[model samples]
Target: MGRKEEEFGYLLDNNAANTEVHTKTGSTDQCSQHSSTETHKSLESTYLGSDDDEVRRSQAGQSCDYGEEEGHLVYHIGLLLEERYEVVSTLGAGAFGKVVECFDRDKGLRAAVKIVRKFESFREVAKSEITVLKEINMLDDDNRFACVRMLEWFEHQGHVCMVFELLGLSTYEVLCQTDFLPYSVDQIRDMAFQIFKAVSFLHRNKLTHTDLKPENILFVCSDYNLEYNNDTKRDERRMRSLDVKVVDFGTATFDHEHHQSLVSTRHYRAPEIILDLGWNQSCDVWSLACVLMEYYLGQTLFPTHDSKEHLAMMEKIIGPIPPHLLKLTSKQHYVHNQRLDFDESSPSGEYVRKHCKPLKHLQRKSEGERQLFDLLGCMLEYDVSRRITLEEALWHPFFSPMRTQKKKRS
Candidate 1:
């Protein structure tokens, strides 16, 4: 293997659970700290409106031009926000805006700031995210799933900025660093426990996290950059060891609202979302099942971007969608009279989907394999009403061993 591939393989070599590497303890002082080597540049913005309600715009040549190109608000380094936090680096770019690493002068801490575009729609969504975050914070004091905490929010430079506690690399990054190798069953269990617990908390609070993909799931540790020699070696020796937290509430909504049915990224999106069926917290369970399968299989369970194609792949893998669920959908373009018709005959005289791969490794009849199969089946049930509850999933025998071990440790 080449150097990059070799480094990726390092991430999948170990399967033992490392306690230190999986600590979920949170600290107020556990903020990010930047190295002095990182560079910063000054920012100049054109001002508009009154002193109390000024909207700032980045000066030409100093901004990322995100606003002009994709309608997202532009951000620049060295921008002093709210006379407190100073932008140090662009952390990541997304559809709304960019997440930047900022230094808080008063708190003497580093934070991740998510800057939303000043567009009215974007601002409204961003406001909703803040509202959801506050609700989660007020209710979840113990941080059961280690969900990301919002420090504060404000308007800065024609953007709605949200300050969050800095988090580590995402599960997506972990998979990529491992060259998409299938994670061990033990590791998958650990992640599922944390994720399911988080989702259960949200559901109990009457909220739904419409997006639940690998990128939205993050590790709690700081130094997750596997490029570092020491960190890489240490992580390789403790493969699948991570303390995970769910992030991104921009698309979340109260279950009663029923306003968002088209939320979630395309690949991990639930069937309800695609068929225009009004969804509740159960939709997140379907998305979570897909993510969990991806961890064990090292690939997305359904990989099509087109709605019809995605539905077809689902049928091939999980069997037909329930007629009742199909009837609930407002959009019937993907569903024909509560039925999906397709030519199933293949060259091998067995039905096969062009996108889905055969489950070779899962052919084993081990206890762990059987348990996972059952858990996935429950989570991916066709009818939302029949789907497994997060609480039930937590107590499921698939995770019973882990729960017993955790109890013994406590």
Candidate 2:
């Protein structure tokens, strides 16, 4: 069976059991994994952010002129920005903007330039995104999280440009080509550590990535070539590495003192978000768990057809709530229609009994997979307060095997 089928089957078989599954037959946590070197180069560049709110508003008079070109206007870096960089090619395109190829004029190096239009309030949003990028860049400099490195930010012809380090293929591309390679215990452990470190850093800074998925994770070619067998194409090998640096902060929010906006991909969103419960950084933690699970299992843990069914699936896994967390729920309609009453033992037991049957199959899976299942289960707990903390997760036995292996090797 495929990884998704295996995961679903496991979940259905072992809803209540606490036993751990074994790893791959021949897999050992002591297996040698590839490592990489970090190189840094400095170049003279100008940085800008919102200096004056009033000045920003006044300058916002400029608007995106979509009518300027019949087809999309391809702006070459050397031609448009009068920089020494050569516009190499297009990296990727998106709704908000397109990342294009560029070679640094003075430094003689390759970089990706993200071009965004000038919207009325978009400048403020861009400024906010830049601020987040700067913070992330600083953190990455010291710890070296797997994330796209920000080179610089600038304005050209009423549009904002963000320069970033060029990396290999995205995880989405890799999964599509290889049909989602079965990650060995060591590979999964390494990827999980990188993801946890990234999310933990964001949480420490009171920042929520808001979006977490395979598509955002970019691979470095050397890493992929080392991990997987077979000499694949540059693009194919790039997909294999699946080394992701979280990108796209347009929907991210800061200032943990208050909730800003409801933002996140539906598949990765937490139950609190779907139920409109007052959410916090924990929501991002939940999403991270979903992404990590998807990577290992090759499909979403809570795959559903629609929002209603999705919510129901989550409710089933997490069980009923406590009075304290229920009071914090924001969606009155959802609470009225979907909320379960666990006040009584029999009714709540019945609820748990009914939902518990579907998860029995999870017991048959391997130990690494079971650990992931349990970790996801904890993250997906209905009561947000009862959810797993990042610190707690760091010390999980799921990670212990790898740590043990690392110590043995050392």
| Top-scoring candidate (TM-score) | 1
- Model 2: residues with Cα > 4 Å off, grouped in runs: 1-82, 222-243, 256-258, 318-328, 335-360, 404-410
lDDT of each: 0.62, 0.53
lDDT of 2 at 325: 54
lDDT of 2 by residue, 245-281 (tens): 6565654567554454444555576777766666787
Task: Give candidate 1's whole-model lDDT.
Answer: 0.62
| Worst 10 contiguous positions by lDDT, candidate 1 | 44-53
Lowest summed lDDT across 10 adjacent residues in model 2 is found at 35-44
RMSD of 2: 12.8
* Model 1's TM-score against the true structure: 0.75
